[model samples]
Target: MAVVEGLLLQATSTGLLLGALVLLLVYYLSSSFSFKEEDNEPPGPKPLPLLGNLLQLDLKQPHESLCELAKTYGSVFKVYFGPKKVVVLAGYKTVKQALVNHAEEFGEREIGKLFKNLSEEHGILFSNGENWREMRRFALTNLRDFGMGKRGSEEKIVEEIQYIVEEFGKFEGKAFDTTQPVNNAVSNIISSIVYGSRFEYSDPQFKEMVNRANENVRIGGSAPIRLYNVFPWIGPFLKSKRKLERNTEKNRKEINGIISSLQETLHPDDRRGFIDSFLVRKQSDEKSGQKNSRFNDKNLLSTVLNLFVAGTDTTGTTLRWGLLLMAKNPHIQDRVHEEIDRVIGGRQVVVEDRKNLPYTDAVIHEIQRCANIVPMSLPHVTSCDVHFNGFFIKKGTTVYPLLTSVLRDESEWESPQTFNPDHFLDKQGRFAKKDAFMPFSAGRRVCLGESLARMELFLFFTSLLQHFRFTPPPGVSKDQLDLTPVSGITLNPSPHKLCAVKRS
Candidate 1:
């Protein structure tokens, strides 16, 4: 009987231990889940399993959809693109705070699958941490050295403007799509800075390169490409993805050819342009036996590619928008024309003349604000876990600084929805600066070529206005001109023709 009692006691002890362990596990898990609930994560639309908020977003105009969501869920909110969670900072105040105030926390570039496949995080645009820092520094320094924003650059642009004027004269006031010529002209400016020389517009190779680059930009933001970003495995099935890959490969080969020619003729003392400067640095790094230098051939190729594409697309698109806007609002165009004719007369419009042309300057600023080309800016990732605006965002969460919201912020602009130059003009009618004018974006990841772009826009716009009057084709009223932008990596004007009538 005693032996039987002992066995029962042992069994009882084992059962109690097992029960205690189960209770402890339950408490720990419950506490963990409760802790997450108390984290005060940003509010967002309810996400479906696996799909997340894919159905909620408009793939074509995701920025527009997010702006609408901001109406219901405040400035700081979360949304899911598939299983990926993203925190969006909307409005001028919120965006500025997150980007400028909390820059480090919200500064890292979020490399989507498409970008990852294209860039492999090698270049300045899609890279992070040490590699990005080194490349950006080098690019900025080299670009400035090659007269990116200086008088040298001004001279290059002035020369290019004459070419553009000559090209427009070829149209002889006939209605023609300005896309190719405008893209070519703007591209040559960067080409001059990158390759140290401009290509003739008639050059087949040059035209092909420019056309391919622009096409990539157009297709990069297509619905299929957006889906590819969310579901990378579907890339092989998507035509857009395959086309992008093909275009990228061809461009890579062409770029390699150009770089090889530049490499063979590289003169250390007479570094011609950005490519020469990079090659010289690469050679120096090699001679020093530097291990893992960021100046490798891959970095050089990717960086050049990044600079070429970025330098061409945004400035070119903005210039196109300016012309289209001028065509759409002839009154605004007239004022701009009057300003240019009044301030600088028939003489060349130089960078130094910007201050004297406040009305014209205001118009340009307003163009950028209204154009809102890079509506989403580039996606940013959190460098670390962040508690921002009463919300907890974990480390590595993708963040979209909604530039569209800031550019169109109701609180910031007096007429946010309209094209109003007075938005940048004070009661005194002088050119005034608004803190919310962030067409190039803000903070650490702000555009590297901002100064260069500013110079380009002013010179290009003023010069074009001086030479020709932009108008919609015959029988197309100003009202009939559509402002609807074609979806792209940059918002582009839809297929339209305008007459660049030579000013009498």
Candidate 2:
């Protein structure tokens, strides 16, 4: 009896100790979650140790997840990206407030490892301080002077649109992939501006450059970039990804070689292309004995490459989506065609044509909004220690515009999920621009190629619709419209081909 009683006492004591431990753990967890409720930082979902809210983030569609989190939190919320924390700005109000109102404070580029190798001293996209100011000013002025953001540029686009129309004829009304041909047209436009020349679609070197550009654009933020971020030292372990890196290096060399050859051939009297204009600037600076003139072959080459990269794929992808959408919605396509015919008649449509074609103009704007490319604008860093929406965003902290959230924010749009051009149009049918319509972004770092992109979108879209009615091949329904994007550095439609059937 005595032994049994002792054993019972030991068991009861063990049970009590175990229960206390469990209770302590529960208290710790609950306290941890509730501890920061009184703080001034923006409300956020609970984070796990080391990882924080990383596991909760959806890698595939981070914007969607962040949007959901925004409801529980607010327009501006902080979320952890691994050990790193990124403050996401959602909706027009928050995004505009940060990007436009406080533009300078948030103007720092994230400077990813990949871009560091490529554009360390290149131009405006990555450079800081005097370099950024100088290059940005020079590029902007030069582009504007060369007719980038004005009616003067319309002639160049009109010419390219004509070429695109000619190529569509080669399809003979048969089904084909419009990606390459569309890209070629855009490349020609940029090439005309930068190199003062355009390449034939048949040029092997041009084709190779196009391929490299496509590959680079397609691989951004892929598993490889993430892997590099996680295990940067393991570059040799990931051989395939290393190959992509090598290919990118090869592309840089080729671009440099081309620029070098062009420089040798450029005559002192003749200044054509952006590079030539830059050389002229350099020579003038030398004559003036200006020290450390930023206008050099390196800067010129980087700027040219940047133009091709940012302009080509982005415009091409949007057009790809636009045509796909038009095919799926023939009524909308017809209305656009009708507008083009009614407004411009048989004359070549110019940048000025937009004022007369409100419906078409609205449709173009809608396409840009709906596409929502660059979900996060190539990561931006805070320029200095600053406060945003009550959060203590430290200096050098990386921030994302969370553009996808803004574009598709239910709070801002009538039908956030649907493809509605009416969002950009008033009840009276005039084109109404939205402050939220920031496909090219806003403020200090707004797209350098905004004018060129808009011109291309209008010209190519109208020109194509004027020439042909795009549709799926017979037996394929609009339901089969591969709306599934090939999501990479750029949002692109799948490999589905379409029939650009020539209109009567």
Candidate 3:
């Protein structure tokens, strides 16, 4: 009887211990779930383990895919590019709010593996903190001094426009690809500011540099490179990455040669252009014995690379798109020509003339809107934990301000998908600027060359329209001329030809 009583006591103790453990487990789980429920992270499609949302993304056209997702998930939503978590800010209001109102919080650049590999956190585009600030300030000051948007740049652009007209005359109403000549002409504008001189269209070194730079821009947005950015371990196996590296090395060597030649003849007292000013600053820093200065050769090379690629590509791409859009929409082209002829009267178009030419100005604005280059304005990062649009975003979260959504916001544009110049025109036909016109982006990270790019677009575009009537190749109808852009770091018009019939 004593033995049976001891057994019952042991059973009772075991049951009590098990019951206490179960209650503790229940409380812990409930609290954990409650915490998650309260966190209020932006909702997204359920991410799979390890892969995240990779399977859902269209790697080639991520901006479009993300825009589509925003339809279901609203403006602020989370997405995973492989294992990397990203919060996308869509539409005009949200993007403006994040980038403008909360600039400090969303101001940092998200230097992904690809950009880090390319820039090494050295140049204005990829670097952050003091390096970015110093480089950007120096670039802006020197660019202004060297005639970025002023009379000096105007003269250079006018001179370049003549060369472009001459090139078009050679084609003589025959369909020819506008890519090379247009790129060369547009590139020379930046070339004058950077190297203090322009390259002849036939210069092998200059042509190679431009070709390589444009090629890198194209490949940098390829599927393999995008995947390599997400899964860097696969970089070694990517032909695209290898080609990019080869092109980068070749371009760097060529750039270094140019810098060396410039250095040999650089006069601190007679600064010619941007590179001269930078070298002068470097020399001064060295003479002062300043330690840990950011003005070193690496910074110089990287900064030049940043400026060269950006200056050459974005402006050239936009100009090309302008021409193509004109060919595709001859009616709009007619109005532009009419406006130019009526106001400017075949005399040389100048920066001062832009204000008088309202329709032309409106057309240019609409062109930028329709082109929508840089659809996913370079990725940004959150600088601190914050509540945005009622969603909690942690510090260091990668944020993409989807320019595509903003440019095409239904609430912002009358005809979001259609190419309509009326979008920038008032009822009385005056040039009207919209608040959502953020082609150069907004806030601290806006394009360093915004002023120059605007000047270039207006001058080059008007000059071209004045000199030539662009049309689809013989036997191709205007409606058939595809407006579909080749996806890249920037959207490029697909491979096609147009005849630049010289105006009488």
Clashes of 3: 0
RMSD of each: 12.6, 10.3, 12.6
Q: Candidate 1 vs candidate 2: which has greater TM-score?
A: 1
Judging by lDDT against the true structure, name the best candidate. Answer: 3
Runs of candidate 3 exceeding 4 Å displacement: 1-38
Q: Model 2 over residues 321-419: C-alpha lDDT tens digits?
A: 999999888889889988887877777776777788999988888888888877877678899987887777777877888888888877788998888
10 residues in a row with least lDDT, candidate 2: 8-17
Clashes of each: 0, 0, 0
The candidate 3 region of ten consecutive residues with least summed lDDT is 8-17
Residue 478 miss distance in model 3 (angstroms):
0.8
> How displaced is residue 479 in candidate 3, in Å?
1.3
lDDT (Cα, tens digit) per residue for candidate 1, span 1-504: 334323322323233223323433544464532112227799989875455676787777889999999999999998876567888889999999999999899999988798788888898998999999999999999999999999889999999999999999999999998888888888888888888899999999888888888889988987667655765654544556778888888888999999999989989999889999999999999999999999988888899888888988898889889999999999999988898888888899899999999999999999999999999988999999899988999998889999999999999999899999999898999999999999999899999999999999999999999989999999999899998988878898888899999998
TM-scores, all models, native as reference: 0.92, 0.88, 0.92
